[model samples]
Target chain A: MKIALDAMGGDFAPQAAVAGAVLAAQQLAGKAQVVLIGTEEAVRPLLQEYGPAAATLELVPSTQVIEMGEHPAKAFQQKPDSSIAVGYRLLHSGTVEAFCSAGNTGAMLVGAMFTVKAVPGVLRPAIANFVPKLDGGMGIMLDVGANADCKPEMLEQFGELGSLYAQYVLGIARPKVGLMSLGEEEGKGSAVTQAAHQLLKVNPHVHFIGNLEGRDLFNDKADVIVCDGFTGNVILKMAESMYDIMVTRQLDDEFFARVNYETIGGSPILGINDNAIIGHGVSTPRAICNMLMQGYQMAYAGIVDQIKDSFKS
Target chain B: MKIALDAMGGDFAPQAAVAGAVLAAQQLAGKAQVVLIGTEEAVRPLLQEYGPAAATLELVPSTQVIEMGEHPAKAFQQKPDSSIAVGYRLLHSGTVEAFCSAGNTGAMLVGAMFTVKAVPGVLRPAIANFVPKLDGGMGIMLDVGANADCKPEMLEQFGELGSLYAQYVLGIARPKVGLMSLGEEEGKGSAVTQAAHQLLKVNPHVHFIGNLEGRDLFNDKADVIVCDGFTGNVILKMAESMYDIMVTRQLDDEFFARVNYETIGGSPILGINDNAIIGHGVSTPRAICNMLMQGYQMAYAGIVDQIKDSFKS
Candidate 1:
């Protein structure tokens, strides 16, 4: 399977993107292909050091580049040949099994919507991440800002997506899902949270664990946490900030030395047709490597296929 | 100053509650007068252990205890002489300068509102807690489930209360007040967060630091973080869950050693007319000691006076 790479994306542009892709392909051997997309001239120099491995790295020519600040929809329309747009187009047109980019998220989401389209029955395609928990397991939180203002129905869909992700990707059977709320009691949240709580209670597919308040996240009460994009995003971002702060403040030399970015890799973009994953913008080489490995693992896990089947069934 | 303690509150009612008060009075020395409000028989045995220090402790007669499942308003009304009710009455009738409880949060909030009353200009009092950043510093997020459904104007007041708390309690001069939202952009967040963001920007007394998302909590970008109780509570609880999970997973030894509740003490009731601090139900001896110390400091800080001044000025 080939992974469409957005060579013109991210702060480091073609250099970091191309270098990471070459390293990924080398590590994966001939089992996978890296189809680089962007201006040939810009990507060629970075490909030079790969030697024989460089031959396996394919390039798709594109003329335009989407500036980071460009309006998402406008940039996609105006720069259809941009690396990000072209990468998604390749996946949309079935040129590759998956697509990867460290591009503007708004543009990426917009592209995903206009190009690949949302999974059928899924109201919103959520961006989720794994948060390490006390039980030596990680919890999956969905709608972590994919759709900021979600309807009651949208939250219900997020529960399914979060549940399915944990079951397939995280390997949690009958993953317990919790609706994020202010209080644990029934009818104890805003209209949105309260209504969502009621829906989850009656929904048979979800292993609804009643209402979980803010402090309950750290507890092993639920395996898959669900909320509207706005609240979920806030929770995700806050947790990320706290983790970063803790690592910076407490973790010492060896903790991140061998396993930094270029090592652990990226987060899988769930609900997409392909295996596109996103990394932290500030991802190091080690983290990028890990992301590549993560992408490989996800593909092997058939997360996308599982999601497709779940959506269908 | 005397503090009315509700001994019949919390899951460990009258047992841990009585013990915590006895411990608090001993720890406070002669600095505070303690009034343990509960059935005299239930508290007397626990008070027996303190003996001399227990001399500073007195029993205020109360028969009924508000059960967690009982309706807060209805229960409080029916049991006017309940522990929580008596505690509030002591605070209101000027017999006690403050009241503290580890009871049902709904009951506490209701008791606070109808008993001690809201500070003069305060629209609503919020449940405020310190989020311990991995950095030695902390962030204060308010309205954490106090007023789940809030309007734009109430959020502005929350910002003010948060700022005042940071200034006097935390000692950050001209505390950078943040309005929590989906993102930091001026136009970001839901309708209420956005509107609150605009109002905070112009409020003279508040050092409005623009919008902050969840990830910003640990960045030290803002000294005082403000959001409606619903969102703030979700963020706080999620961050808390992350902290609990990370520490337990990575620092097992430290987790056990620092396993006591003193790591983060109880939350304080802000925007009230009296000095009231509500602790976590899972309070340990160390946690109770720390909470009592905090209650003392809050009294010393004249937080109630400052809140009153906010209204008068």
Candidate 2:
């Protein structure tokens, strides 16, 4: 099996990307091969520096790059030879099991929709981020930024997508899904959440745990928390900010250390037809390695197939 | 000026409320008076126990109490003499300059709406909570739990209301009002926030700043952050939970210590005809005392009158 990374992605690309690919290759030695897709000129020299360590890593040449500031849809269309575009092409043609990027988030999302595409029955694919629970376990929150304005049906679908990922990837048994709202009471939320709550409660697909307030994100209340992308995005950024604040204050704690973006690697674009992960723009080598490792795990677990199966029935 | 408290409100009421009233009374000795409203039997003894410390505090008998779990609108209508109801009556009749309760949150909101009522031309009232900025200063967030669903005009009004509070009560000059969104770009956010952004950009009542992400909450980006009630409430509860986590871990940090609910005491219901604050349900004496002090400050600043004037124009 081969897992791919966009070597020209992220701020410190080529160097960080190449270094990370080497690290993942070492860890996945007997398990899988790691592929790097980028301009040969930028990546060849870096691979030479690693010499034997970079020997296990495969290089796929792409002449163009997708600058982060360019329009996602426009750039993805114009730069067919871009690393991101090529990575998607490889994944689509069964050349790689998974594709990962620390590049333009919007572009990565656009590629996921246009290339791998949404699973047959999925209304929309959601970006799922990991939340480090207080008890040292992990939970997943979905629709992090995919569909900012989500319908009740969309939120209900997110619950199912997150639940499938939690069960198949995270290995949480009978994962409890919670709808994010202001109050825990069934009647206490915006019109959309209130409607979503009703749909989730009766759905046979999940162990719906009713409403969850924002405070429940890090608790043992549920393994999957679902919400509109706007709410989830705000929360994802806020939690990240809090972690940044803790670091700036030099207040080190085990749980907070887990909150760092690097540890989790990247947010997976769930409900897509195949495995694809989006990393932070400032990802370090360690972060990139973790992201690649996560990509391998997703591909090995075949979470995409599980999602397709779940949505089919 | 007279500031009234619902002695029978909150979980630790009577004792906590009486003790807090004494603290506030002492602090406002020459400037204002503190009035406690509760069943005489429940409050008189607690006050007597304080001896001379409670001498300056005045008691107003309320025959009924609004339990935390009671239906807000129904209970307010059925129990006209409830401490929360009595407090509002006093505020409405000009017997007290401000009214505060840590009781049934819904009942408190009901009383505010049914009694003192919304200010003329105010679309709806909002609950404003204080956010502890990373800097030593404080900023206020509004519509924390009221009006879970809000219109674009309502959001624009919230920005105006929060700006007034920041300027008059919090004493921040030309307070920057920020509309919370998924991104900092003007074009980002939900349909409502997108439309609201346009309204706020040209509204002369505020110094409308561009969009703010969740990560900007603690930064010096905006003095006033306007969002829908659902988003605001989630953020408030999430912040409170983070504070709780810090406390449980016993990580002593001055900045996080300021995030404690006791420091701010209560959330003020803005755009109402009179000054009204709703304290935390688990209010300790310290929290209650701070709430009363906040009430005194609001009354002194004449913020309600300011809101009325702004909306009137």
Give lDDT tens digits, candidate 1, residues B1-313.
8777778777777777767777788777768877889987888887897687677888998988888788988998998888888888888888887777877777888888987888888888999987654345666888887888888999999888888888887888888898888877897788888888889889998999898887777667888888888887777666555445545546443422332346555778898888777877766655655676777778878888887888775
Most accurate candidate by lDDT:
2
Best by TM-score: 2
Instruction: Give the TM-score of candidate 2 (chain A).
Output: 0.99
For model 2 chain A, give the 10-residue run with minimal summed lDDT: A304-313
**Local accuracy of candidate 2 as per-residue lDDT tens digits, B1-313:** 9999999999998888888898888889999989999998999989899999998889999999989999999999999999998999999999999998999999999999998899999999999998999889999998899999999999999999999999999999999999999988898899999999999999998999989999999999999999999999999999999989988988889998888999999999999999999999999999999999999999999999899999995
Model 2 lDDT per residue over A1-313, tens place:
9999999999999899999999999999999999999999999999999999999899999999998788999999999999999999999999999999999999999999999999998999999999999999999999999888989999999999999999989999899999999999999999999999999999999999999998999999999999999999999999999999999999999998898999999999999888999999999999999999999999999999999999995
- For model 2, the superposed segments whose C-alpha errors exceed 4 Å read none
Q: lDDT of each model, Cα atoms only?
A: 0.76, 0.94
lDDT of 2: 0.94
The prediction achieving the highest DockQ against the true structure is 2
